[model samples]
Target: MSKETETMKHNAEVAQFRFALIAPVIQGLFPDASATAYYKRVSAAPLMLPEGTSVKYSYKTLENGNPCTAPEGLIH
Candidate 1:
């Protein structure tokens, strides 16, 4: 791919990854909201993290036998 094309591809991947990260949270928080409204609400909410900390998501099995991704954090 050309340099510009490569950059666009990477940007699209990043956007999709970010959406995946937030999708479950948005759905849980706004179960009855439309997609457009959910996006609006989530975008307007404040996401605060402590200094030297990062968020990470991990997939694990729940007691009910369903797999889920839970967000965790690492603090430096």
Candidate 2:
């Protein structure tokens, strides 16, 4: 649609890429961790890393699920 909207989307995409790049770096410091494990830890860190860093994980979610875990939770 508009230039402003397009710019915003581009910026968001860039931020996601940057986060993904940093994720592995942060995960590498851990001992014998899987990629998914690294992603999980990285996603949680952004939750408290100031506004900009936190924005990178705005839509992040864990893949862990259960048949009886949070039957009424919206995220489940």
Candidate 3:
């Protein structure tokens, strides 16, 4: 495969792995929640971050699938 194709494949694999890691948690939190709705809510929620910081923020998924800023760089 070409380098670009290989890179794309790797990215796709990583995305799938990330989804796998989070899917169970999302399911457990919102047993009846639709994936589309859950993602929409998550995307709309404000990320908790330090003021005046332009850092890349990480989020923790709440019981309702809401995304909250992780504390101390720890995933909730």
Kindly list the per-residue Cα lDDT of model 1 for residues 1-76, writing each as its tens digit.
Answer: 8999988887676555455535554447545355444444444544323332353333211111112333432110
For residue 67, what is the lDDT in candidate 2?
18
What is the Cα-based TM-score of model 1? 0.37
Worst 10 residues of 2 by lDDT: 65-74
CA shift of 60, model 2, Å: 26
Candidate 2 segments exceeding 4 Å error = 27-76
In terms of TM-score, the best-performing candidate is: 3
Q: Taking the tens digit of each residue's C-alpha lDDT, what string does model 2 give over 2-62?
A: 9999888877776565544444434455332554555466556545332345543422233
lDDT of each: 0.42, 0.45, 0.45
Q: Output the lDDT of residue 53, model 3.
A: 31
Model 1 stretches astray by more than 4 angstroms:
29-76
Q: Candidate 3 — number of clashing residue pairs?
A: 0
Error of 3 at 26 (Å): 1.3
lDDT of 3 at 12: 75
lDDT of 1 at 55: 36
